[model samples]
Target: SQKIEQNSEALNIQEGKTATLTCNYTNYSPAYLQWYRQDPGRGPVFLLLIRENEKEKRKERLKVTFDTTLKQSLFHITASQPADSATYLCAFNDYKLSFGAGTTVTVRA
Candidate 1:
């Protein structure tokens, strides 16, 4: 069985600072990992995706790192703002897609 875990507690950070989130998995080897952001009542918006062979990937102010050996992934948001505040989710695909519980980020101005 595969399990994914993210920070269940809310993450509070000051605006303009960087925020980092972690995703850990057990008993799984995914081909790729993806991150998404969901607002209060909206569907998740795709952020970044990193493949197993890739060590790091970046898009705008977002960055992601995938380490197969450690079975973990790290998601980063640089120069975060209030607009960036949302529940971030980590998902992976082996033969099927699975999602984490998600971590809520609150960027205070």
Candidate 2:
């Protein structure tokens, strides 16, 4: 009965600032969580993955935090640029696999 939720609105931010997006779910236990970035009219591209046992993970300008107890995952982009603007998705595979609604980020100078 777990359900996932992401920001449905577009996020607009100034260049050089960080953008934070959120994913929250309830009522289920997940083994792993994956994040992906998708551009308009293009397929999603993988960003990072965090296992259920991992609390925090970072890769370059990206960071992810997974809290199994709270059933939440946070995705961050540091020193964001216009090129980083895209829809960010959080997904986890169970039997059928599921994805969040995705949050679109727009960075402007």
| lDDT (CA) per prediction | 0.93, 0.92
Q: What does candidate 1 score on TM? A: 0.95
Model 1 scores worst on lDDT over the 10 consecutive residues at: 90-99
- Give the per-residue lDDT digits (tens) of candidate 2, residues 1-109: 6788998888999999999999998877889999999999999898899999899999999999998887899999999999998899999887766899999999998
Each candidate: RMSD to true structure? Answer: 1.0, 1.1
In candidate 1, which residue pairs get closer than 3 Å at backbone N, Cα or C atoms, i.e. clash? none
Q: Native-vs-model 2 lDDT?
A: 0.92
Task: Please list all clashing residue pairs in model 2, or write none if there are none.
Answer: none
Per-residue error (Å), model 1, residue 36: 0.7
Question: How much is 75 displaced in model 2, in angstroms?
Answer: 0.3
Per-residue error for 8 in candidate 1, Å, reads 1.6
